[model samples]
Target: MDILLNVVNYILGFGAAVFVPLIMFVLGLCVKMKPGDAFIAALTLGIAFTGMNTITSFMTGAIQPAAEGLADKTGLALTTVDTGWPAMSAIAWAWPFGVLCFPLLIVINIILLVTNKTNTLNVDLWNVWNLLFTAVLINYACEEAGMGTTVAMVLAFVGAGLMAALGIKIGDMWAPSIEKITGIPGVTVPHSMTFTAVLMFPFELILEKIPAIQNNNVDAKWLRDHFGIFGENSVMGLIIGIVLGAIAYGELQAALTLGIQAATAMVLFPMVSKLFMQALSPISDAVGDWMKAKFQDGRELYIGLDWPIVAGSNELWVLTILLIPVELIFAVVLAPIGNTVLPFAGIINTCCAVPALLLTGGNLIKMLILGIIATPVYLMVGSSFAGYCTRLAQTWSPDSLAGMGENPSITWSTMECPDFRWVLVNGLSGHVVAIVLLIVWLALFVLLYKHMAKRNVEIKKELGR
Candidate 1:
């Protein structure tokens, strides 16, 4: 029965993944958009952003050894999974919800569009999916490559920003020349692509031979010097040689630190300006360049402005605060509900965070409500289905469990035994305590919201709104 159930569950989970995207595409079609457009949007939202779990899994597998080695070197416990409240909740629930809540997400988005008078469906903001996906992917890549979180975040921010900016800048600069040369309307040489490709081999070499340099502060100067090399041939050689020499000297820590900081500054400068563009003519330079390209009938004008880069509204901090309780409820309450019907079923809770974050527009309150309501249903229905599918996989691939015997070895018995006495005492009880604390936090948030609402009402009355 367990085996049969696991099979059924796997099929159901897979179905949900497929169905949700299809429904989203259909919704797009209803709005006179192409199916491809809808798929792209869904991909941006679902697979691109929320699929960080898959990237994390890959990175975890790759970086485990490096992390352990770092721990051995630094003697700091920086390698362990963050098992704190909401992070723990994410571990327990985010992935499962990602898989199960596809259809519900479509329904929710539709509702939000229909009901909200002020909030129009900004397809542009859907770019958040791209940002989320890229962040996670880059994060995993850096971590797996032995880069610490701080270093990775800095590099990612710098690298992505520089590449994006250079691409736009170079494209703008070369637009007229490219058009005159090629006679193509929207086709122009991608300066960013050239820059990236040029840097790739050298970057890889640096990462490979002198892995420790990832901790360094030399990245910024390197980018600045190389930033001007598109014009000069000999300068390019000099840049390459310097980069190689730095890596050979294993000054990665310095290089990385400097590079990240510089890159961050470059990226954030424009973003900050965009933020206060209303008060100041910030990014006026870039805007002027864009206008020149458009006036000149250059393809470079198509390199649209990345509003997020221009506006420092990452909102990650806001999302984190809002998501805490939702994560807690799913990890603590809903996970157990699934486990009761299906042994080894607690892992499915990892899916809950996906819907909570994506569907709720990263709103903490909505996520908390959804987590309270939806997790139980997912666990009951989704886990039962997933558990059964896993059993089926085992049955089908007997060699997958070939080592098992009627009288399995003591070690195996200890490891695989269903006995949960210690687990209940340690894991369950500890989780329960965590959940209680989360509930208190939620209560405080509710009170805060109420107070804010009252203040808003008072302001509205004063203004006669």
Candidate 2:
């Protein structure tokens, strides 16, 4: 197990910039593309990922100061530190048993695909960490309940498989919405990050039924046509950045600098997205062709990608920037009620924003409310599980919390496990409340799965798809 785990980690350790391209290169050749063409496609994907990572660094550079400024200005001192998903993912991989989940999920995905149970060939293999983390948490719960290691691991792996299937279903339902919203074809985000949309689905649908909300047809494009540059996406980003900077720094110079940075991001994100779309085409075409050949219905196959594919939408960034102060306030308010997460590291919160953008069809009002609704949940989950996460970090990967303190509680605030999965796993620990909540969450998902398909269709027609 150690040898196999080391090999997998060595490859994945190269990160998405390498791992995704390597997979795509192999997949491209498997689908019968010429070696030269496959190489170009793979390299292009590598470049696109590299560019996205660079932009992410720029975003973090801008936001980190803003986060610090917000913390300083607000004077809040929540105890648990939010390390964000990257650190948490590393912690998941460090779990001695987590390596088993890597291959297990790969096989599960293939089985699901071949059985016609899920349409997504989830090539977003790096996110297997999400499943691993889920299982690790479940394993902890089972151990606390006095289960043996063998029983705990079996239960953990079972829970992880179910969650993966749920995510695949979500991605399948979400495919059309991605196409309708971003105009990107043959791609879907089947990763756990997108599972956040489930929280907003019913609420967005409710808002759609309200007369006032439904009747209001005004949007950014309308404002752009009538009011010109002020409504433009880049200008909107600049305005948001300036406002955030002012709130965080309380200074003109810093505000303008951040404003320019945000505007630059708004302009560059879409340009980079164009590169990704271009590079993904050949590989996507091959996958689509392969799927058609296998299925007589000529159904198209969508590549399950990382959520960053939709991060280019100015709507996503718009809501994300606007929510920073609100999220800080949420953390501060919830501090008294066991919510100790400070909302610092994962302050960008695209995990919620990406899905909200797609589910709401870029409707800023709906997206804003959806984010507001999800914030407390993220905070509470972070708080509820911080100690376990920290303990796991200490046992398996102490370096993860090295700089925090002697024994600081660490939490991945943004990528909170979807409500049902969390509750269901906790139910295994024999908590009556958790068991009841698990049932409620399952019922909700059952209904949600029913409506989401139809809602996505409505969204597609709205986009003229």
Candidate 3:
């Protein structure tokens, strides 16, 4: 029965991805839009959903293996007694320190959202995942080749860290050059030093929890808060700090438990929230844009609530309080029946929050209603198509090594393999969806172009000598 339900839910999820876009098209047409306009909107929503899913899946694939290798080397068990997902060991070890750092992360994400700037710091989430994965792969290779764990960890850390640092720095420096070449002014890289430091918090926790490195007295929490240490502190000092902290903490098991929970919350909650936002974004944007056009008399109103603000808001607090019982009910009543269903509840919670935020905008009730109707339809179509494509790519190339064979040197395979696949899948999906939707959007753009051409012909006819 549980398996049947899960299969049903997965089917429903895929359906929702397809359904959401079709609904968006119908809503657009109801507003007297040309077929082209409606189609474009639907297509754009589809593309966005697909792109995000693809990137997310690719990152997950790359990171999970590395995380597993790191766990094995550190003597952490790989299986969760409950779900059996790779225990997110690094995150698990850092759980205790996370308590001190979680609030700060919320603040940083909120600031970024409110400022409306794309932060480079946000990219570090991906970078850390990638680097950690790379470290794991390298460590695995070392062990397979008969190197000691100590040597493997050291080499992996140094190699991955140097690569990460170089990639980040080069990307930052070249961003302006690319923008200039494209003639776009005022574009800056996202994620300040502060944001990057905060992003590294989970990784720091992982480092702290490793038993072998327990002698290093590293204050993971303190380093997370201090940019100078991360930026200029000597490598020896960092290692020493970790060794000392582990020794001071004493109970490796307890420290590991705390670290896992903290890192889990840090990664899982933010990711869940992002997924909610992605699911909600098209609807929110459509509704907000419609309301401003129909009701706002040239005054700008913030209709969408950014995720960070939502996480920090009093409303969220109240919602969390309300949800506690609901979560408990699911755990107690539902988990006995099946545990996988619980994660879906989290997804549902996020989905519910989107419509709530849209409705709360007050002045845009009609638009909100339209958005509520349209969101699910878009999500159903978009997510399914994206997930399918991403999974296909993963099946084709399960590892970076397979994707980039015969390259003994590192030679940018990290970026090259994943980047090429991501661009190809995302770009193709976006363009194809856009074209298909254009046909349904009332062909307003096409009609306008034809009308202009006719007018030019008439002018030529009138001016003939």
Residues 113-160 of candidate 1: C-alpha lDDT, one tens digit per residue: 355311212222212222222233343445555768787655544433
Which candidate do you rate higher for TM-score, 2 or 3? 2
Candidate 2: what lDDT? 0.80
TM-score quality measure for candidate 1? 0.27
Candidate 3 C-alpha lDDT tens digits along 1-465: 445434433433443235445655665665556687667656664554444444334423322332333233334321101211122222222222212222333344456445633222222221133344334444444554567878766655554453344333323232332222222221112211111212122333344366544343222233344555442223322333233234334456533443343233333332343443443344435544665677555322222111221331122222322232243233333333332222211212232332232222111222222223332322232222222222222333234224434421111101111221222222223346543543432243234334334543553354441
User: All candidates' lDDT scores?
Assistant: 0.31, 0.80, 0.33
lDDT of 3 at 199: 18
Quick one: best TM-score, which candidate? 2
Residue runs of model 1 more than 4 Å from their true location after superposition: 1-8, 11-20, 26-40, 43-47, 50-70, 74-439, 451-465
Clashing pairs in 2: none
Which candidate gets the maximum lDDT versus the true structure?
2
- Model 2 lDDT per residue over 381-460, tens place: 87888877988899999877777876588887776555655685788766899989877776766677777788877776
Error (Å) of candidate 2 at residue 319 is 0.7
What ordering of candidates by lDDT runs from best to worst? 2, 3, 1
C-alpha RMSD of each candidate structure in angstroms: 20.7, 1.9, 25.5
